[model samples]
Every structure is written in C-alpha cells, then in structure tokens.
Target chain A: MALQDKYAELLQTATTLGVGNLASTEQAGVLHVSGTANSTADYDALWALYAKIDPNMASGDLMMNIDIKADAGAQLKVTTDSSNLNIRSTPSTEGEIVGKAAHDEIVTLVEKTDDSWWKIKTADGEEGYAFAQYLSPL
Target chain B: MKLTKLLMVVVVSATMLFVSCKPKDADIKAAVEKALSADPSMSGTTVEVKDGVVTMGGECKDDACKAGCEKIAAGVKGVKSVVNNCTVAPPPPPPPASLSTTIDATKMQQVKDGLKDIAGVTVEFVGDKAVLKGEVTQANRMKIMQMLAAAKVLSDVSGLTDKK
Candidate 1:
C-alpha cells in the first residue's frame, strides 16, 4: 500500500485536532506530514496515535514535524554571558517581559516558539520565552 | 536412680500431651488482631480463630493491604491455615468536575514545571485552588504544597499513591 494511504488515519486525526498550517507529501515511498499543534497535549496526542498505528516508530514510512506549544516536559539551562535572560510572553524580543532567569539557572523548556525563541519556566513559577541562543540542553 | 528416671519421663510426657491438647484459639486470635492493628495497611481487618484455623475478613484499601492481612494471620501462633475473605475497597471517584473546570492556565503551567521528573502525577488549577493527583511521596507532596502556597495559590492534594 502507498505510504500516504497507509497513514490516512494520522492525517485525518491531525486535521480533526485543528492543527494549523498542515502540509503533507509523498516521495520515495515515504510520507512526510508537518503542522503546528496549539498545545503540547495535542502534539503528544498525535505522537501517541502515531505510535498506536506504528508501534516502534521504526516504519520509516512517515515523517512528523509537528510543533508543540506549551512544551513543559523539556529540561534546559540558561547559558547567557554574565547576564540574566529575559522570559518574554511571546516568541519575540518585543514580547512582554514576564520573568527573568539568571545565567546558568536550569529551567524547564516549555515550548519551541520558533528557531529564535524558546518558552521556559523557572522553578519559582515564572514562564516566558527566552532567546534560543542563550538556552542549552541540560 | 532408675525409678527417678521413669518418674521424670512420665511427667515430661504428660506435660507435653497436656500442652499439645490445649486449644489456642483465644491466644491465636489475640496475636493476629494485634499484628493487624499494628500494621497501617490492615486498618479495618477482623480475624476469627477456630480450632487452629484463622478466618480474616474486612475491607482493605487495595490488593496489597488485603494480602498483608492474610500474611499477618498466617504468622500467628497455632494458626494452621488462613481463610482470607478480605475485600479490597474500590478507588475513590475523581474529584467533581467543578474542581477542574475553573483552573487558572498560568498557575497550572507553573505547577507542572515545579514538579518535573515526578512520574504519574498531574496538577491543575481548580478555581483559586490547585488540585494534585497521582503518585507522589508525602515529602514531595508537602514540598509542592508549600511552593504553591508561597505562590499564593491554595491547593487540595489527594490520590497520592506512595511509591513502594
């Protein structure tokens, strides 16, 4: 069976979940689907559904590029150079400054708003996105 | 000397027979109940001893508690076998939906981050209160409660399955 047809359930589920900017294509017997889920729960749900359909995710027949917002499961550390990092409300420098993280403070990465910005929350309950450059995986 | 030896043997044998023939139901029941009451798991259990056989019956919080009652019963003196009839209590129902519908998104997110790496647990805002559920140690539960309390958020913590 064609990979696209084989993965119709996943595509239908993504659409049903109201994923934004959804795109799908097939090439070389592989199906690639990309989209942005509004929340981490939605993204995780999609991954779970995918796993149910393809248990090991080993099929290589599909590629997923779903972006999850509000991703609190990731642990990261701030690596700013001798200065604290600002946690902004949005994924932009002009976004409201809701909190700040000291340099080298380990923070929970909540979301990858984009390549340039990451949403993080400190241990004290302050949450906002920081510049991606200053954040490092712990 | 030989007559004294015979008399000693008779006394020892009679004592042994008398001791063996004595019914130990009361002692066995007392010991089993003592053991059960000492264990927190067997809180609501009751034991009956009849002819060296034990019958345990009551409600336990879970299967482990039910099994613990049987083990305590079997270990009692003169208990030849245990007839376990304890029933495991069903898990309490989830909190009322009113408890979850009014959660503050920002505070809920904060609670989630504060409890990183703790498995099988979730916290959410319920109106002005934060409700915690799933597996969490008492120490961690108190810690989380303190953090939220300091945050000026009231919290109701329950459904804590203490880690084994």
Candidate 2:
C-alpha cells in the first residue's frame, strides 16, 4: 500500500468518524495511538509499540501526543543541528569524535546506556552512547 | 568429516545470500509502505518502485511533501534511482496558450522579471495571452495575477485573460 493510498484509506477512516485535520479539509488528522509503555530494549520494538498518530507533525519537533513525564513510550524527533551530535572515541569527552549522523537530524532514544550516558545513532546507523544531559524530551 | 563441514558452511552462506537479495516488487512496495507509515515525514503521498526505479505519482500537500518523498525514496535498499512524477498540490494554472505575437514584447519583459523572483512562477507572453508557469506559495501566485488584472484595467493590455 502506497502512503497516499494509505493516507486515502486513513482519510476514509477519519471521515467515517466525522473528525478533520486543519491541513486537509477532506481528511482528519486523528488516528489510533497506543496508550501504553513499550520496552526500550530495542529501537524498532519501542517505536512499533508506542508511536503516536500525529497527522501534522513538522520535522525537528517532538511527538506532541506523548507527554515527556508519562512513564509511557515517547518518541522524540530530532529537529535541530544535532546531525553532528558526536560521541567521543572513548567514554570520556576528551576523546576523539568517532562518528557522525548520516541522515535525519532527529533520533529516538531507546534506552539509557549507563548512569551518565544514552546510546544514539552514529554515522553508519550504529548506536553509540552519549551523555544523558545532552539528550532531552525528559 | 571434512565434506560435512564444507557442506554446512556452503549451506549457511547460501541461506544468507537468499535472505539478503533484493525483494520482489510486491514485497519491496509493501516494505516501502511500512517504512513510510512508520515515519512521520512521509505522510501524504503515494509511491511505487519497481526494479530500482521508483515511480512516485500523487499530489503532495506541500513542498515538504515533495522533499520528504524524495528523501525516503533515496533510502530504500536496492533503489538505483527514482523518477519523480509526483505533483504537489495547490497547483498553478497551466501556461496560457499563444494567441498572437502582437503584444508589446517590452511589457512581457517587465512581467517576466516581476514574476521570476517568486518561487515556482513562470511567465511567458504570446500576443495578448500571458502564460504563467509555477503555482502559488506563501509568496502568492495570485500576486502576479492580481497585478496583471489591475494592469489590464489601467493599460491597453486589459484584454489579457488567464485562459489565453
């Protein structure tokens, strides 16, 4: 199913419910959302479990439906200049910049790596640990 | 035995090869849909890719839709390239047909210069007909249209119609 087709399907589903989106008058933005927490052991699993259906989210924004404080799954879209959010070669900040992000400026957090660090996407799409203070959506 | 070990190695490698080959068009299309659905950026478009050639056709809601679709299409595994036939919405009027070559060529120059700065707007004059290319954005495709309409009221070119 192409997204446009799926979007059409979703629009059809929305019309059946009488809700509409601000962007498209014929279509509705509201869709299903999982109101539960997902395990953070894996990145894909976490998103599959708790991603929200936001019809009008812009790049570099947070998933508005997920409250930061909610013990549930909150997926954050990185929307800034964090494509170069680097992790040092060693655990220490004094080390060299090992890798960089090759794609989207945003990254969703899967889990805390250690007391001071959280693993994030590196250049090759591999996950590496970064200091927790630099990560937000807390 | 030595033969058994060799057979086991060959079987495992072949299995890995089979699993990693480019999926069929149906499977690839399904994966593309799933991947786009999972991501928020690719929300309002339809895409079809066959044999590494992506055939994207649909009205994108905005420029973001165009850019987002292109970005996602670039990432699908085994995609050699894409043919972007996707149309963005809020479409601009089709260029006016040439009616005659008698309109003042200098006046057409002024109109062309005024509208070119506007993104996606193209202006061409054929006799009394002024063909506009590119649709409207936040800058207003109507701005030029309004100017032309008003100019007609003030000048001899008032006979200019968008339909040409």
Candidate 3:
C-alpha cells in the first residue's frame, strides 16, 4: 500500500491516458505495474513521470512493464543512434544477423515475438526478428 | 330507496379516487430506475417494483455501490422499501510475480544483448544481480533500465556513471 501511494500519480496518469489492461500489484516490497500504452508518446510520458517521481529510478521499488501498442502491419521506426538495427534469424542475438535496417528507417511489423524482440520486415522485403528497444511504433 | 342507492354510488366513487391517487407499481419502478440512473456507477443495477417496494438486481462494483443503490432507491418518491439483490463483483486477480531474482544463462545473455548497442557499459553477473559498470547519457540510462526491466533482470547500476 505504501508503494502504491508513492506511485499513485503514475498509476492515475496511466489510467487517465487510457492505458489498456492496466494492472498493478505489490509483491515482496516491489510494485509491479504492467499495461500497454496507446502510443509511443504515451509510453514516453509514463516513463518520464516515473523518472520524475523516482528521481533516476534509483529506488527500484517499481517495475513498470508497459509497452507501446503496435499490431502486425503497423509501421515502426528504427531508433538506433546512427547505426543500422540488426535483423536476426531468431528473436535473440544468438540468432544469425539476417539483415539490417538503417537508423531511422521505417519498417513493417510482422509480429511481436516478445517484450524484448519483434519480428519486423524492412521496406525491401527482408524480414526477421529485431531488438524491440530500437524500434518505435509509428 | 333512491337516496340510499345514490349514497352507495358516492361511496364507491370515493374509493376508486383514493386508489387512483396512490402511485402504481410500474410508476414506482420507473421513478426508482430514474433515481439509480443518476449515478453512473449504478448503471449495472436493474430496478423492479411490486406494491411500491423496489427490488434491485444486477451487479455492483462493490459493497459500497450495492449499499448506495439501495439508499438511492429508498429515497425515490413512492418507494415503500428497497430489497437490494445486487451482488458485488469480485476483484481482479493479482498479476504474477514478474521479477526473476535469480539470473540464469539465458537471462544473462539477454542482459548482454540489451547492452551490446550501448557503448561504455559492461555487465558482470554477481549472484542474482547484474552489476553494470560504465558511463551512459541520461537517455541511454533510461533505455538501459527499460531494457533490463523488460528482460526481468535485476540490476545494480550504482557502478554506472553518468556520461557528460
């Protein structure tokens, strides 16, 4: 309840922003909140609020498992810093590098393999899994 | 004989007028429904009236809402009493524990893969925690934390420094 009180504003904001499947629970002194934000902007806003509330998020008392809402066939932008994003044969770095999408290039999402990886197809028709962190849904 | 007959007719007419003045069961039901509808939370409640007594059915979000519906129905005009048949909905189940305290091989590799693109950051597996040491910009710092959270990797970023 104390952790809930501490992150009440963050939870309230998430609800106000219409986050889908918003769920929160406290376990073993940590508050775990998970949901899907309607857009990347909403996701960023929630993260910003979280950082502001926790100050560099050093407390480690909250695990926000929110992700941006993106479906198959949605457009995603490569967010790597001036480097090409790797497309792998599988949803891991252990997978061979099958292709690459240049920084800031738009790609089509084929499926979300997991929270950490998404299967995406480049405009040239090359398709494979990529680290979801470097892809922002458009 | 004519006077007696006229008196009987007058008595019958008075009784009919009194009965008409009393509100009908259907009218009481409508009024109770209208009163409950004033509260959006009471939308799930259904109202019925018999002999001016209102019977509320359907689901309520909680006990407070159930009690509230009864109060509102009782306050309505022509309502003799209220029978709250509304049931409180059960709370949603809590989410499963997500943070994996122990670091396995796959989790370690995930941590490494997440940090591969971020320069200057190195990871060491110390017991269950991923001890991160290096300098990162604020934006990258957030990205690192988000990636770690997504992978459910417990981290000790205290060794990590802020890059100017």
Candidate 4:
C-alpha cells in the first residue's frame, strides 16, 4: 500500500482497537532499524500504523517503544493475555504483529532503545522486543 | 561650641531631606520588575518607567501578555498611569507540516482539552465559538487571551478591549 493509504488504515484500526490505549498525540514520520520479529504475526495492521508514525524501529521493537524515546531502564509486567496473541511491531495500531504471545505471558523489560518500546522476555524465558504501549506499568 | 552644634544640626537636617526625597521613579522600576518576574507572560515585555509615568512597549506573543503588562502597570505601587503600547507577536512554534484541517468541532474540543491540560485555564466552547469566561492569574490570563485570539475558532474574536 502507499504511504498515505497505509497511514489511514492504521488510523482507523487505532480508532477501534486502541480505544483507551491509544496515544494522546500524533507526530511526523519516523525510520526504523532493528533485528527483532513478532511472535503471532496477527498484528500486521498495527505494525503498519507504527511504521507511519515512526519508521526507524526494527521489526522486533514494536511492543517496546513508548510515545517518547527515553533511555530509562525498563521493567515489564504482563497484566492480561486474552484470546488474541498477536505481537505488534510498533506502539500505534498502524503497526503489524510479527508473532503470537501465549496466555498468561509475563515479559520482563530489559531496555528502552526507542519511543516507548522495550526489550522483553516471554513466559518461556525467550528474549524478544515489544512496545511499551501494550504493557501497563509495574 | 554652640555655633558648631548649630552647623551640625543644619547639616544633619539637609542629609535627612536628601534621603527622604530620593527618586520614587527608581522605586517604580523595581516594583515593575518584581511584579513581572512573578508572572512569566510579562517577562518578555519591557516596561519603561520615568518619573512615575510608565510607558510599556514590547512585542508579546499574544494579547494576553499585553493585557497582563497593562494590569501589572496599573496595580504596581508607584505607577501613576500606564501608557501600554506593548505589541503582540506570534510565537515561533514550528508550522504544522500539512495543516490538517481540524474541524471546527475538533478545534473547540482541542481548545478545551488543551487548556485543561495546562493549569490555571478554564476554557469553554459554546457552539462553534470558544468562550473563555473566567479569571486566571494575571500572567496566565494574559498569555491565554493571546492564544484565544489566535485560535482558529476564535479568528474573529473581538471585544478584547471591552472586557476590561
């Protein structure tokens, strides 16, 4: 899809699924370069949104980046894992999910490399990248 | 000895008069500085005080700053009357890349929400028109007034002078 079309698609998804979790503001385009990939791959639309909002993040950094890129230390705590187990690439709904997370997953945040995105660990102690957008503070 | 004593008293009296009559204009300048420092919006506007007559001039970012300068001038202790000639200028905030046409409705909502996020403003938008209908601290009120004037919804905002 074209860049503008991609952004619009992401915007629509964010309006619906991101309801209370949606970001408070919008910003210009961003670029990405990371080595991580998603788990479930069901969150493609979400990753697209993230790319429009910010393009620099690697595929693995989606679930870990926050609204603003802070170098602060991160610690993740999983509060919920429902029917859908899709892992997204960016914080916004426009991003795509590259992987699937299991139920009752607890990911420990290791670092904050970009906007609200953090490095996390899965239930089986698998280290991966995620966006802070989906996780609540500990 | 008595002659010398008399000379001393005369000299002392002269000193007293000199101290008592020191320039109140300086006092007025200090007072203006004190008031402006306590308020941020008026920090940029310059105040010229001479012989207790204040002439204010500077380009503030908005009408609120202008009003703030005037109000501060009037309330200050040594001020006789303020000749507020302060000018209003736009902020250097970066221009929006593609001015996304925020709907009039969205404009009103953003105004209210934006004002609320910042302390000291109680903003309200009735219909498509936003009406800011309360008092904020003098400094904050000044800047807010300027924002209201520049606000897209309040493009035709008039009666700013009539309010005070």
Could you give candidate 1's per-residue lDDT for residues A1-138 as a string of tens digits?
887677889889889998877777675454656666776568657877765786434354555655544345667778665688889887665589899999889899877764446778899999988776566654
Which segments of model 4 are wrong by more than 4 Å?
Answer: A1-138, B1-23, B91-164
lDDT of 4 by residue, A1-138 (tens): 333353455546645553222332232232111111222122333554554564422211122111221223434445322433345565333347655555455555556533334566565655545544344333
Give lDDT per model, in order: 0.68, 0.44, 0.87, 0.49
Candidate 3 lDDT: 0.87
Candidate with maximal lDDT: 3
Name the candidate, 2 or 4, with the larger DockQ value: 4
Error of 4 at A68 (Å): 36
As for lDDT, the candidate ahead, 2 or 3, is 3
Ranking by TM-score: 3, 1, 4, 2
lDDT of 3 by residue, A11-93 (tens): 99999999887888887677888888999999999999988998877777888888889999999999998999999999888
Best by DockQ: 3
| Residues B17-89 of candidate 2: C-alpha lDDT, one tens digit per residue | 9967867777666666676677564566677877767777776777877777776776877667777777777
Better of 2 and 3 by TM-score: 3
Better of 1 and 2 by DockQ: 1
- Spell out the clash pairs found in candidate 1: A71-A110, B103-B125
> What is candidate 4's DockQ?
0.02
**Worst 10 contiguous positions by lDDT, candidate 4 chain A:** A31-40
TM-score, cand. 3 vs. native: 0.72
TM-score for all models, in order of appearance:
0.32, 0.27, 0.72, 0.29
Write candidate 1's Cα lDDT for B1-164 as tens digits: 99999999999999999997775899888888888888887878888888889998888899999888898788877789999899899775332222222335554554565555356778766656566678766545434543443233445554445666
Model 2 chain A weakest lDDT span, ten residues long: A58-67
lDDT by residue (tens digit), candidate 4, B1-164: 99999999999999999867664887888878788888777777777888789988877779887888788888987688899888888554332221233336545544553354235445555543455544344434433432332233332122122223
